[model samples]
Target chain A: EAGVAQSPRYKIIEKRQSVAFWCNPISGHATLYWYQQILGQGPKLLIQFQNNGVVDDSQLPKDRFSAERLKGVDSTLKIQPAKLEDSAVYLCASSPAQSLHFGNGTRLTVT
Target chain B: AQSVAQPEDQVNVAEGNPLTVKCTYSVSGNPYLFWYVQYPNRGLQFLLKYITGDNLVKGSYGFEAEFNKSQTSFHLKKPSALVSDSALYFCAVRDGVNQGGKLIFGQGTELSVKP
Candidate 1:
């Protein structure tokens, strides 16, 4: 029973640069999610996917943030021209049932 | 709109003593409540969930939560705290009717168990 896997545990980029975070969900999981957690705050949902199709992304910033889950097993979240305010931890979670299992997350530091 | 509230920003308890972390939720119809713990630099781990049935639900790591429908509260408890129990605790809730079943999370409470 391996947990959800995320890549590049930490990332640092200058403002206006592009950064991307990748997530590989657990085996046989049908739902995947992306969340952003700022320091001292709880994680906020960015996007959610049920299989290869998106379920909800209303909170996502369409101007600069985009995400895709091509095969329904793995997903990527991309931020174009990242802003300083974007400095936060990006968490990837997967769920086979109602309960979610989270990954270690990627800490993004925007300079 | 569904929402969760963790009123305390931090809580401190001595090892071997009882510990309690407060949580409250608001949602239409029945609520699906959950508790999760997050260690420093790590992601959230599920501690417990209260969907239906018993008001008191036990979970991993000797943790338990009491769900009170009258008060609309779900508080995490431990009979004897350990230093290892220190972490950030989150309270979340989901509306029963939402198609995506997205959870609404509280701000999180930092629990410190001093040895």
Candidate 2:
């Protein structure tokens, strides 16, 4: 089976700009997750989705970070007014009830 | 809350020597432990996991981990290290107490194999 897919493998934008990353989870996986990985650190869960509905987003910065998993399949994470600190890798993962499979991720650089 | 810890920031070893990357975790309920390897510019690749039963689980590429419940540790081990094995290793956990399929990951341990 194919792994999770992510678009725009790399992106560079100025601060205060808006950027969006897209993810396509594995077929039939009910759970999808978005994670932010700053350099020299672990990946942090920004949001989680069960089907088309959100299950968790407590760590998400609601003011600027937003994510949607529409139609219970694909997801999109957007960061409006991207901050300098927002420069990191945006990872997408999906699970079939156990361990998650991850994508190559989009490396976002906010200048 | 559930969390994971990789005590060592990095581990250095020779190509033919044994290697171990330490990991410990905290969870409220039944603990599910996993190991993942990440190469530069690539996504994490699953290594092995401990769901239940065997304390020792074998995984891809001659990698294995021992789940020590008493010590609350799950450490990755390989008998003979390869230069190609150099990468970042992460420890992750999912707990029944946490709910859902959420996973908490460790900061990661960088492994370097010298020839």
Candidate 3:
């Protein structure tokens, strides 16, 4: 079976610019997640969605980051006015059960 | 709040030797523990999880982890290490009672198996 899919394997943007990342989860998966992994650090959960509704997004920076899963199949995460501290890899994952399957991730470099 | 900690920044072991990556956690009640592996520039892949079952849980790629509730620890282990096994490992935990539970991840442990 195919795993979670993400678009734009890599991205580069200047500080204060805006960037967006897309994710397409596994077929029939009920839960989707977005995480941010800074270099040399473990991934931090940014947001989670169960179907079309958000489950948790308490850790997300509401002032600069936002995400949505409209159809419960695909999702998008956006960062406006990006900061240098935002340079990290954005990962998308899905879970049919309790175990999560991840994508290759989008590496964002903010200069 | 639930949180996880990977005490080691990196671990180096000779191929064919036993390997272990240490992890500890803090949670209010019973914890749902997990281990994940990530290759360079890639996302995390589920390795194993301890969810109200046996203390020792085996998972993909010949990996296993022991969950010690008394100590609040879940350390990843393997009998024989391989060069290919070198990668970053993370430990995570969630509050069992929280329906919409969110995983709290450790900083990560980098494993290097030297051939």
Candidate 4:
């Protein structure tokens, strides 16, 4: 089975720039998630979607970060006017049952 | 609030010796614990999970964990360690009730197996 797919394996941008990350969850998976992993830290949940509906995004910084799941299939997470602290890896995962399968992730380096 | 803790930042052992990585968690409802391993520059890979069955659960790559409800701990263990077993291991707990079964992860523990 194909694992969750994410694009732009690496991205480098200056502070105050806008950047977006894309995720394509595994087929037939209803639960999709976005997480941010800083160096030396475990991944932290940014948002979760169940069948195209947002289930939880309380940790998402709505002021600068936004995400959307289209047709319950793929998702996109965006950071506008990114900050220096936004340098980290963005991981996308999908769950068909209890546990989640993750993609390689996109590493964002904010200068 | 549900949370998991990996008290150790790193664990080191020689190959052919037994290895243990400690984890503890606190949550309401079923503990629904899990262990995942992540290699550098790669995503997390599921190693095992503890839902409701036996206190001792076996998983991939010759890994196993004993779930102790009395102590609220789930520790990953391997009878014989291999150099290939080195990676960053994360302990997570599934929130059985709220936030759509969110998985909360600990800071992660790095394991180094020297041959």
Candidate 5:
């Protein structure tokens, strides 16, 4: 079986610029998640989706960040007016049950 | 709130020697623990998880973790280290009450296995 897929393995943008990352999870996987992994830190959950509805997004910066899993398949995460601090790798993962399977991730460099 | 701690920033070991990465967690109720490994520029890959049963949980890549409830610890271990095993390891935990399946992760520990 194929693993989770993501696009634009690497991205570079300037501060205040808008950027978006995409993810396509494993077929039939019910749970999808987006995480931010800053250097020297573990991945932090930014948002989670169960089917097309959001399960949790408490840590997401509503003012700057947004994500959607349309039709309960592929998903997208956007960070508008990006900040230098947002220069971290964005990871997309999915779970069939308890254990998670992650993609290669998109390395975003915001100037 | 649930939290996890990996006290060691890095650990160094020689080939054929044993290796360990320490982790501890705090939660209100029963906890579900997990271990993951990440190569440079790659996303985390699941190693093993402790839902219940025996304290020793073996995972992929010939790695294992021992869960000690009383100590609130789940330490990853490998009997013989390999240079190829050098990578970043993370420990995570999920609380029973929330059931949101949200995981709290540790800072991460870099394991360096020398040849």
Candidate 6:
């Protein structure tokens, strides 16, 4: 079985520039998630989608970040007016039940 | 609030020796614990999980985690560690109150198996 898939494994953008990351979860997986992993820390859940409907996004910074899962299969996370502090890896994961399978992640570098 | 904690920043063990990475959790209800491994520049790989019915859960790559309910801890363990086992280990938890199954992760522990 294929694992979760993400695009543009690495990204570089200037501060205040907008950027987007894409994720295509494992086949038949009903739950999708986006997480931000800063250096020296664990992955923090940014948002969660259960079949194209958002389940949780309390930790997400609404002022700058947004995500959507259209059709429940693929999702996109966007950061507008990116900040230097936003330089981190954006990881996408999918879960059928308890255990989650993750993609390689998009490492964003904001200069 | 649900949270997971990895008390140690790094754990070092020699090859062929036993290894342990400590983790503790806080939750208001029954806890669903998990362990994941991440190599450099890579995403996390599911190692094991403790939902119920098992205190000791064996997982991929000869790794295992023992969930101690009383202690509120789930520590990852490996017998006869290999150098290839070196990686960052994360402990995560989900609580019954959270219907979404969104995980709260620990800060992560770096494991180094020296050959």
RMSD of each: 0.8, 0.9, 1.0, 0.9, 0.8, 0.9
Indicate the worst ten consecutive residues by lDDT in candidate 6 chain A: A93-102
**For residues B1-115, what per-residue lDDT tens digits would candidate 6 score against the true structure?**
8999999999999999999999999999999999999999999999999988879999999999999999999999988899999999999999966646799899999999999
List per-prediction Cα lDDT, in the order shown: 0.94, 0.95, 0.92, 0.94, 0.94, 0.94
Docking class of 2: medium
Candidate 5 lDDT, tens digit per residue, B1-115?
8899999999999999999999999999999999999999888999999988999999999999999999999999999999999999999999976666788889999999988
User: Once superposed on the true structure, which residue ranges of model 1 sit more than 4 Å away at CA?
Assistant: none
Q: Candidate 4: TM of chain A?
A: 0.98
For model 5, residues A4-106, the per-residue Cα lDDT tens digits are 9999899999999999999999999999999999999999999999999999999999999999988999999999989999999999999888888999999
- Tell me the native contact fraction for each prediction: 0.63, 0.71, 0.83, 0.66, 0.78, 0.85
TM-score of each: 0.98, 0.98, 0.97, 0.98, 0.98, 0.98
Against the native chain B, each candidate's TM-score is: 0.97, 0.96, 0.98, 0.96, 0.97, 0.96
Residue-pair clashes per prediction, in order, are 0, 0, 0, 0, 0, 0
Give the C-alpha miss distance for residue B20 in model 1, angstroms.
0.6
User: After superposing candidate 4, which stretches have Cα over 4 Å from the reference?
Assistant: none
Please list the residue runs of candidate 2 whose C-alpha ends up more than 4 Å from where it truly belongs after superposition. Answer: none
Using lDDT as the yardstick, the better of models 3 and 4 is: 4
- List residue ranges in candidate 3 displaced over 4 A: none
What's the lDDT for residue B64 in model 5? Answer: 98
Docking class of 1: medium
Q: Score the docking of each candidate (DockQ).
A: 0.74, 0.79, 0.76, 0.71, 0.79, 0.83
Please identify model 6 stretches exceeding 4 Å from their true place.
Answer: B97-99
